[model samples]
Target: MTVDPPIRLGRAADAAAIAALSRELIEEGLPWTWQPARVLRALQHPETNVAVVDAGDELVGFGIMEYLDTDAYLVLLAVRRSDQRKGRGSALLRWLETAARAAGAERVRLDARRDNAAARSFYNEHGYHEIAIQEGGYHGAVDRIRLEKWLRA
Candidate 1:
């Protein structure tokens, strides 16, 4: 069976799904945490969160962010386990970039675990470059690599 991809602004009800996806990604020994309540709170507050949903009306991925003057820091970007490798992550990222630009952001930044080679490769393919690396940044164990992408005006 085939499924149509849908990208749309997230609503409050999507918090659980978003959190579940995050937990799955991390629990599978990935490199992140899943906090459903925290994510829901952030999502309810438009000032710091945004999400992308699939055609099935399920939250597939989200981007938690914080604005720093003219730039937006992407705190997190995760796709559902069942939804990975289908271009959904890239589409959500593009949407986030567009949204950031519309909000007057000149650039966007995100940090990925240094050990997450898949994520690193994905970001590199999407025009994001490693600008810095924090040694032992994550949980005092795994290093974190900072990446940034400048948007065109």
Candidate 2:
């Protein structure tokens, strides 16, 4: 299905949908369960949270950015499974990069499980470089790979 370009900072009412989609993606990537309420709380907070909505007014994707001094951490970025390859994820990432840059962040970083080959490839393809491999990073069950992308002002 063709989806319209996403609308930014859509609405608070879509937080639950975004959280549910995020939980699904996280669960698929890792063996952990995420609480929807907690996710909703974080997303609804006015700080560095952002979401993208499709023309149908459905929550297609969301991204959370945490600003720390001179760096911005992409705490979460998830797109619904049905919307995976339709440029939603890329658009969300681009928006986050711009937001990070506006927040005085020189770079954006995120960690993906080393075993999640698809995610690793996605990040790499998106201009993020793996700077380090963290041994036994995921509850001592999986390793974590750190990725960072330098943003241009």
Candidate 3:
């Protein structure tokens, strides 16, 4: 599932589009936790980052990552349902990793729900390994599985 290359850094004007795409793609309560307002806040935040894959003017996918110390935390990633399996997710992820490395991150971390097999597979295929899982990790609705990947040897 490969597409064209070059994922871009999301901007302030992209907040609405990113938020809309997330709402359409995410099938959980996490989007409800942040919503568009929270996304806008992240856009303005210095420690957080947002990257997107666009097809012309339409944003097809996005990922939000936060830099904490020497680690980059992937807070959220979503691709348009119609655009899934087309490499957008992977491209955005790669871009995030590059950004993180440039910011001195030695490793990247993310969390997925235990019920999300597809997400778990994606992370695994991208070199991320499960580190831990906490019961009722997602607002007591689902267990959150933490995954990590070292960027450098």
Candidate 4:
């Protein structure tokens, strides 16, 4: 019987691995912007939360969320391919959402590539609604679907 890794706030030391995971899983087919330096900046940002799941050996998943006055922006979320469908992604998302709500955020927003049906379905299952579609949103190269979830009435 083996227990799964726990999700926690990402540390500066985890920046490189998190950025690598983001590049491999989330930023695929797009320009690489979430590099280690950028990730470290997020880790140190006052309004940003960089959550990560450490698998002892390395980071198996990570999510970055920025909290604002009225809402939160889920900048990125991704779990390792081998760890998908095991609730890790959901746990990360829920953790981020709870933090946002605690910060007085009434809504959470994110974007997914238009071609990623799996990602769209995942967000839909988690109560996010499609708010709009931005043509060539990713570096003016890929179409993106914007999603939002209201945390309160």
- Which candidate has the highest TM-score of all? 4
Error of 4 at 58 (Å): 1.7
Clashing residue pairs in candidate 2 (N, C-alpha, C atoms within 3 angstroms)? none
Task: Tell me model 1's lDDT, rounded to 2 decimals.
Answer: 0.77
- Per-model C-alpha RMSD: 3.1, 3.0, 2.0, 2.0
Q: After superposition, how far is residue 80 of candidate 3 from its true place, in Å?
A: 0.7
TM-score of each: 0.86, 0.83, 0.91, 0.95
- How many times do residue backbones clash in model 3? 0
What does candidate 2's lDDT look like per residue over 30-114, in tens digits? 5544456666666666666665757475677777777888899988788777878877787788878888888889999899878
> What is the RMSD of candidate 2?
3.0
- Rank by lDDT, descending? 4, 3, 1, 2
Model 3 residue 93 distance off true place after TM-score fit, in angstroms: 0.7
- Cα displacement (angstroms), candidate 3, residue 132, comes to 0.8
* Model 4 RMSD, rounded to 1 decimal: 2.0
Candidate scoring better on lDDT of 3 and 4? 4
Indicate the worst ten consecutive residues by lDDT in candidate 3.
Answer: 24-33
Instruction: Let me know the TM-score candidate 3 reaches against the reference structure.
Output: 0.91
Top candidate on lDDT is: 4
- Stretches of candidate 3 exceeding 4 Å from the true structure: 1-3, 27-31
Residues 31-129, model 4: lDDT tens digits: 889999999999999999999987778789999999988999999999999988988888899999999999999999999999889889999999999
Candidate 4: residue 17 Cα off by (Å): 0.7
User: Backbone clashes per model, in order?
Assistant: 0, 0, 0, 0
Model 3 CA lDDT for position 135: 94
